[model samples]
Target: MKFATTVLLTSAIWTTSALAAPRAGFGVPPKAPGDKNGALAAEQSTSADIEYGYNWAGVIHTTPPATGTYTAASATFTVPEPTATDDSSGGKQGASAWVGIDGGTYRNAILQAGVDFYVEGGTKNYDAWYEWYPAYSNDFNLSISAGDIVIVKVVSSSPSQGVAILENESSGQSATQTLSADPSTATLGGQNVEWMVEDYQSGSSDVALVNFNKVKFTGVQAETSDGQKIGTDGATIYDIQQNGDVLTNVTIISDTEFDVSYEAAQ
Candidate 1:
């Protein structure tokens, strides 16, 4: 997937994030932060629920032992070494870390993979991606740095078909992306199950945002459909608040483990 013919509609109503419109990372979930144009109503209320979006921030589960749906998902992050954030006037700044399956509440499609960090002026880069969210973002010659140790996963066999995997494990290197047909016809409705730390998009808006200062996710599992294998206590917490500050601060550390840090915004 890589055809930026210009498409912009990253909607993350945070039913745990993304709210469909995919990108779960890339142009990165939009439409929640403050209701850019106004149109979001997911929230079911389990307790957590601290909204704000523009490019996701962390954690977001599905159901509540309320049956099954998700195909599969996994996480194990640690590759933050991005600097330059005063909004990074130096041109570009992005940070991505993913583990997705369905763009949360079936916003069309999304089966992800992760690892991406960039700093323009000072020059810094890294890659290892995979996607199927409204398209765009496909690179995995595999070669990463800066704390490495990643382990992203995604799986789906129906709703269009999918399979994305990325593992850096500090360097052991691993990358796989299989698809039978899941491009523009994207459609994965396993609902939401995400663990992101993203601030992506370089063409239609949202770039400048480095200071990765934080990013953590430990084997946060997910594999439902009936087989059952979920974790994420009572998910629902997304940080990242653009102009209003409130960079991020999500901490769960239970049903699997979670922690997303990086303040500075105010």
Candidate 2:
């Protein structure tokens, strides 16, 4: 990743949409609406529960330690869909969510419990793998050793003490991050979740957000960059290919809270 000598802890505990972060959709595929509460939704729930059971981790030193000089590059984000998400939601509907990952080799990744809340119904899932391109070129340097993962959470920002952690395999280095807002009681489709990228090595990071307004599955209008009206199907998802296609473990913490973990194959 590129070094931004100055690093700020962009830990703004505010609830907004998914697209709220920067460069969240540089060259990735645009996500259209998917099924309201279809099979994909069930898969998300099942996947999230399984993925949260155990922490995803790996070690990089085993592959090959930096020999001559230590160099790093920011992984390219080039998938058709957004890296993290607050899926199709609207003025009156439940919550939807998704997660995708790029390439990387790690020792351990864990989903720590945070604040708790209650919700009627919603779905969430995660995907991990390598991509041909990174999210932003100028933001970080690209290298074979570096990689990125995607995490998506859909829920009301009910005040809870929940956070997730990603640990470096070789160095045992790790970073603790908050997933959503800290509110007491929140209604489904009423709040937004912001996806973030933090550099554990230097503590610098960039943020992207998708607000509640951006999430709409059916009977609503969506605006593209060209200003064309589009109907959201709320079902389409990106695919994972080759040596990296895998689903993380998940565990349900409560009706509204849960844990998810996944690893990007090296």
Best by TM-score: 1
The C-alpha RMSD in Å for every predicted model, in order, reads: 16.5, 21.6
Instruction: Report the C-alpha lDDT of model 1 over 1-266, residue by residue, as the tens digit.
Output: 22121112224343223211233332334334234524332344355766656557787774435676888889888888888876566787766777887665456667777777778778888777787765655778888888888888888877778788888887798978886344546677788788877765544554656788878799899888788887876677776666556677777868887888888776
lDDT agreement with native, every candidate = 0.68, 0.20
TM-score of every candidate:
0.33, 0.21
- Model 1 residue 142 distance off true place after TM-score fit, in angstroms: 5.4
Q: Which ranges of candidate 1 are over 4 A from the true structure?
A: 1-48, 51-59, 62-65, 73-83, 86-94, 100-112, 129-139, 142-153, 156-192, 198-223, 227-235, 240-245, 248-266
